[model samples]
Target: MRISTRTSISIRSCHVRRNGPHRSSQNAWKWVASRSSVELAGTGGWLLRNGKGLAYPTPAKSNKSMRSGTLIVLFQPNEERLLSAKAMIDDGLFQKITLPSVCLAQHCVPTKGGTIAVKPGRVLGYLDSLKFRLSEGARRHSCGTFHTGTDASIIPDYADFQLDVRTFSENTQKLAKAAVERIIRKECEVAGFPTTPRMVTVVSSPAIYNDAVATSQFTRVFEWYYGRRASEVVQEMPPDIVADDLVLLALPPGGMPIPYVYWNIGVTDPETWERVSREGELRDLPPTHSAIYAPAIEPTLRIVIEALALAALTFLQLL
Candidate 1:
């Protein structure tokens, strides 16, 4: 099998999205460099400011490879903040490049190393993060009853806390949010508060829905590469309780929904995987986002890079 080397790639800072509008492609490209933040790179070398990164590979045959079309790899940031995708849309991402036929994303998980975890629908739950601050009026009266203050003589004037709710469906999310608000308000009323506590929504994101057809197509590529049954190549993972902002990338605001698939790559160390499995300690393995969590780098990177190339080729019809 032959692969073409001609491809184009560009890297830009996550801050660019929140900065302002991009009048032109050249103007937008200026914001690519970022020194203080971590940057993720693909197989090709760094995507420099001088337009130096390769995008995709195609078959060497000139005529056939030309039919595969150009590939554009976008490395986005701010996913932890749940605003990367929205920021890209607001910054004219589609305007700067041709609208993509499909979008793909992957994340590293604590699953056994060298395996992939994916499913066709409802990969992750919806998220609603809220911040609340009880006013001074309520705190003075409530502190005595709630025992919120350390000093016996002085009553606390205010209290603040954050709440996060996750569910698999929009209806459930709505119900949960309403219930939380009702409980908080009822408590405030019982305390004889003059004013309601301040409430602010920190995040509101929908559940990630994987396109069935797109997921199947990608699964076939994995099966072919691993020379294994589809079930073995693609782990039969149920919908995860975690939530992410990647869904925002697939469903842009005020735009038609695009086909997309998001999957998790196993990143545990091989020796650790076997040891834990043998001792029935897999349940205790450190998961993503934990302070002690760390993945074996070499094979994890190899698997992810291959998965990306295979998926790209499948979508481009170059396979």
Candidate 2:
């Protein structure tokens, strides 16, 4: 893909595919980052493309970067989102939005009127992980993942997490996986995407996960991530191709329900949710990292649920 004049911006989308090499048929698209919000870098140059996927390389310009974000929910990206992203010379969306947040008790009620007497922050914790390459900041988190789709059946996804899993092997893995499961289901059950923002590189990578779960945990992680039995979303979201950042979009058909429900939960680490501070008394603690896995479909539903619930409660009080 060539843009003669900077004004003639044309960014083509790439779907997820196999690990195989780029085909001769694949056209190269230029991704030039903006030096200033109003400026474009690649006035005349071939944008770099390699194993790392697509990028709009910008020259060292103004010392600052514009990290604007957008969240959108649509069946498919209409032309506008793509154009908006390209026009901005986005670094990459995957890296920009995948952030792990504290899982607060939003919808549920005051359970422990008779509920378990667990300390606040102690019984509730959110944990996730990310692994990357040997690029600029490759030593730590990756520069964002490859397009979820490649030569193989292409698909993509993303989200974020932070958990502390230590002690017995089973306990750590189990609790970690449980948090992931609840999140995906709840996300699919509650919220959604932003208005529609482009992507960006992290400029740098921090140690994404010194406490990343072992590869053995892949199956269990996949199960919880999709809120389905293992391999449920495998065809589209294969495990091997997954990288640091995941861009999942849940649009059109407006929203949907989770076909899977939690029939039973294994023994949960009663103390897993406790929040720990570096200054607080030290105790034997397990390693942890943020898991940013964004699934477009579920999060959208999650947002809808929250909105509806608030509306309902407001209506009831009126009566």
Candidate 3:
């Protein structure tokens, strides 16, 4: 993709397929990063293509990189499970590509087709998942699932369920954890349980905290690019409950955390957006994970490519 500037800005793009296990992708990453230090890097696995499943593309192994700085695009393999960032790190991701000065990530949101949203500080929430198993008891209480005698005439004695808690603050997370445990125990006690319920933590991840200064800087760049449509296209939003492990990409093996920004690009089809807006039904739009969720093909991809290119240039100081 080429962006018009005093000196035309050209971005090289490439694709790497994970042939073997997860580590195979890491090896491919090493091959790409072997050339030079990555100045501006963008990593994400959520973006979709016109047909079939998701697409994974990198900005290396093309003709050559930018004259001033190298821009490498990394794809995290398991972002939905919230394990991709840590998994990549465990496979020695940083050893190949030196830690970038700034990392960037973006997701397709349910907003209007031509708009983008940016939040400065803690945008996403912390996630904690727990599994609970209630011991056999004379009485039964409501849970995610219950098991009992073979016949429906008998009362259920055992139950098990999994719960995930998301919070934006440390104090709230602590309080939530305590409250979950207390409620589980109290419910089992009230139902006359024979033994204490077993509660086990399945997984925990920190919130996605965007660097305030970097986010603000990116907002300025976006506003400048949009010009008259700046107010309509660029949205400053509040913290959301959507949680991701992308922040882990900023921390080097043993070094300090680097600055990064993870924003959202709207992908709803323009016609659908307009109809929903006209009917005041925007709140009913399908979100990212909904079964019926599908983003438009044209403007969404256009914005993603343009936004990514602009972000890379901004960090490279070529803008």
Q: What is each predicted model's overall lDDT from 0 to 1?
A: 0.64, 0.23, 0.65
10 residues in a row with least lDDT, candidate 1:
1-10
Q: Comparing candidate 2 with candidate 3, which one achieves the higher TM-score?
A: 3
In the range 1-319, model 1's lDDT, one tens digit per residue, is 1111112222333222332223133333343323212243332212221222221222212335345655566666545567666777789876777656787767778877777887898889999999887765534335643335667666667677888988898998999999998899999889776779888888888888888998898888888878845565568657987787766666655778878878887878778888999999999998765545555543554566566667767777766
Q: Positional deviation of 278 in candidate 1, in angstroms? A: 3.0
Model 3: how far residue 37 lies from native, Å: 24
Better of 1 and 3 by lDDT: 3
Question: What TM-score, over all chains together, does every model reach?
Answer: 0.75, 0.15, 0.74
Model 2 poorest 10 in a row by lDDT: 258-267
Candidate 3: regions farther than 4 A off = 1-66, 137-158
- C-alpha lDDT (0 to 100) for residue 77 of candidate 1: 52
Candidate 3 has an lDDT of 0.65
- CA lDDT for candidate 1: 0.64
Please state the error at residue 209 of candidate 1 in Å.
Answer: 1.1
Candidate number that wins on lDDT, 2 or 3: 3
